[model samples]
Target: MHFNETELPGVGKKITFKNSEGIYTVMILHHNGKREFYYLEDDDDDEPLFSTTLTSEETKELAIKLLGSREDEPDDDSYDHMSLVRKKALVNWVEIKDHSCMIERSVGEAQQMAEEEVSIVAIFREDDLLSKPSDDVMIADGDTLMVLGRKKAVEQFENICKES
Candidate 1:
């Protein structure tokens, strides 16, 4: 199974999962603690075959079940997609501290990520996740940024953020 994630701005994040059997599942996590689920027959289909919504608590329960308990014997079939993602790109969680160069600058001015081949995937602040942050979004002290890129580029970005 492969899952692709995208930011929906004012809405939330959208995650799509596809399996080799041509099955597709989409989950939209709203900022307001709601989740919408959709299913598609195949990639060519624009409309979902079925759709439903889940409350935040229900979603959490489902996630726990899917992840299983630590005691549960590891199954060979239970693969971790995060490891695959890490293999292809370096992901970092950087905190914007006092006096850091990133503190008050917008993403565009603070870090020209495209030129560096690095991408700021999300900003985590006060338990809220902002995915696909716009260039105008300003960084603030105490903000946690999630960035992705090749190792060297990611390190460069981190260095830029850490500068006083």
Candidate 2:
């Protein structure tokens, strides 16, 4: 698989992933939390064969379904597809312990402190979930960080969270 990403000025971003069969799946992430998906038969084609839009919530649900959690594992035949997806990206949860260095730090501050690039997609605090929290959001002890990034970056982030 091959992928390309382009910034869309004030709009958001455009990402296109080419599968083994040469078909392209394009995803446009809008700044307003809307997502547009398109399928292209040829790389040079300007018009998509199919297109659809999804809200942020719907996007999250679709991602969850694609990832298949431990409690809702897909059938064995879907393992290969799942494996491919896992190899390309990773979504993980890192719990902030009492000794964590991230405690009390704002999300923006913590992101700059780390050498690796991993996105803090959401923060789970007991009964509440702060999705796509602002930069000023503070990290608290026992809060679980929902992070997304490459495998190596995510691993490095987990290690950073363990440091006092």
Candidate 3:
């Protein structure tokens, strides 16, 4: 089959601009100043009313991919395009916290944990949720890292590193 006939990894095709669901496909704008794929919902009159799509995986996939990419890299990169988000690594929590640590090593520690096959899950900056954490994001005094890893790994990473 041709590319159009098959499921392309990072692409969304407008399926019947007008459907019974009253949905139209429109691109969603992002804060980074990028236009991503989205399925827009419309009415029989084509009066676009609402659209709904994911900014990130409800799980660990997109979050991890987001962490892996450089802050300035274009979102067009294939690595940045995946339909299913990675599941956060299984983990345990002894205490609740956000950042990795205080020292410069904290950054490294975060990477190490990420590399260790444990997912950072979701990060929180105050009340705002940081699903995709940037490398340069500062580890302030009040941040929370939702870690996903093995019970031991999560506990160690949280108690000894992320939370301390």
Q: Pick the candidate with the highest lDDT.
A: 2
Cα deviation of 83, candidate 2, in Å: 7.7
Q: How do the residues 1-164 of candidate 1 rate in per-residue lDDT, one tens digit apiece? A: 77899976444578999867777988877553458888899856777899888765676567768888545544333333322334366566677899787888887676584356877789998768999999899988899898877655776887877789
Which lDDT tens digits does candidate 3 get at residues 1-164?
11112222222222324445655555433221223444445324333455444443322345457689546543433433322223223332122334445434443356475334555545665557776565565555555565555434554565566444
TM-score, each model? 0.46, 0.48, 0.34
Off by over 4 Å in 2: 1-87
Using alpha carbons, what is the TM-score of model 3?
Answer: 0.34
Find the candidate with the highest TM-score and give its number: 2
lDDT of 2 by residue, 82-145 (tens): 3234445556667899999999999988877768777888999988999999999999999999
Model 3, CA-based lDDT: 0.43
What are the per-model C-alpha RMSD values against the true structure? 11.4, 13.5, 14.9
Between candidates 2 and 3, the lDDT winner? 2
The models' CA-based lDDT, in order, is 0.72, 0.77, 0.43
